[model samples]
Target: MTSIALITGASGGIGRGLARQLSAQGLRVAAVGRDVDRLADVEATLRIVADTTTPEGAALALETCVRELGAAPTQLAHCVGTTLIAPLHRTRPDVYRELIRVNLDSAVYMLQAWLAALKGAPGSAVFASSVVARIGVANHEAIAAAKGGVEALVRSAAATYAAQGVRINAVAPGMTETPMTAGLLNLPAVREGAGRQYPLGGVQTADQVADVLNWLLGDGASRLTGQIIAVDGGFTTVRPLVK
Candidate 1:
């Protein structure tokens, strides 16, 4: 049977790549995001405009996908997130709250709505985490804390719903080149320096990360649950050799 997938943040980098890749593989894709026109060219079975950070919006996104696509989406990719490069002291209250809303809150709200939509049926969910959430990275206190919550949410939800046939996992990637990150990577010097930080020797691409997210949602990952897969080019695991 063709799998029905609900991809949130479908207009963004990794989410867009996943949507196109899954659709190309013959899966039915319901690409959803807050911007209607942005999600227009995401290459999916359908495009949905919905803000999934709120409970109401998340419910609407899932319900609309089910009602419009004619089935409960057995696969989900929650890619809705933002980045912040700042120290905890410099991070303002409003910035932290917004960070939580974008990164953590969306994960909680969307996962809740998706599981409820499944109604005891087996399903898979892959959320986006970051390498900073695992290892220490300076000036990354905000993102680290936010995505850390996402990591915890994935593991806890996986445990809670395992008996119910729900598989919850997350991918923690390192410095990736996306529109949302262009400000940090657009300069030639900064880009080279950023790439050098990875032991694997380069930054990541949207498609590269999407590939893992795709696998987690597939049958091959049948036993993989509650695990945070690091797709960070060994940034969190290995240190580069000295000259």
Candidate 2:
């Protein structure tokens, strides 16, 4: 049987890149997102229009993929997330709720549906996390909290399904050059400052991060599980010398 790969948030930078790469590898890909027009540009076997933030939508996406692909996805990449920058003091309740829904809740629901569809078959899943979840970043309380929940969920879910031969992992990228971070990077000063903050001296790109994620979802990472790989240009682990 042909392996099927499902990617959420396929309309976004990371998601679109993953879709193209997976499709290139000949896997029957299902690209899931809310925007039909944007999803049209992604090269996948099936483009599923659904809101992954909701349980119903997540289930529908999986169901549709199964109907089209004739089997449950053997690989899952959840790229849905929000890049909200706000300290708790200035963060509104609604914004926090939306952050949680998009960054955390969406993964929860999507994983629930994905696992259910897989039954007892072995599968691999990757979630998109961030540097804020590992360290303290100012003005990122809302996004950090939400992604922190995602990390927790990845570990717990990995533990829960490990014995069943299901692998779950996450990749936490630092200041990637995606549409989600365009607002911050568009400012030359902010972009330069952000690049300097990374020990490697530059921000990462969506395709760069997607490369790590694609490995985690393939046989090459068969022994890996419950791990959060940081693709942050050493930002999360190193401290460069001051000039």
lDDT of 1 by residue, 143-163 (tens): 999999999999999999999
Residue 182, candidate 1: alpha-carbon lDDT: 85
Pairs that collide, model 1 = none
| lDDT (CA) per prediction | 0.94, 0.93
Task: Candidate 1: list runs displaced more than 4 Å.
Answer: none
Cα deviation at 95, candidate 2, in Å, is 0.6
Query: 1-243 in candidate 2: lDDT tens per residue?
Result: 879999999989999899989999989999999999999989999999999999999999999999988999989999999887767999989989999999999999999999999989999999999999999999998899999999999999999999999999999999899888898899999999999999888888899999999999999999999999999888878898898
Pull out the clashing pairs in model 2.
none
**Weakest 10 consecutive residues, lDDT, candidate 1?**
177-186
Q: For residue 52, what is the lDDT in candidate 2?
A: 90
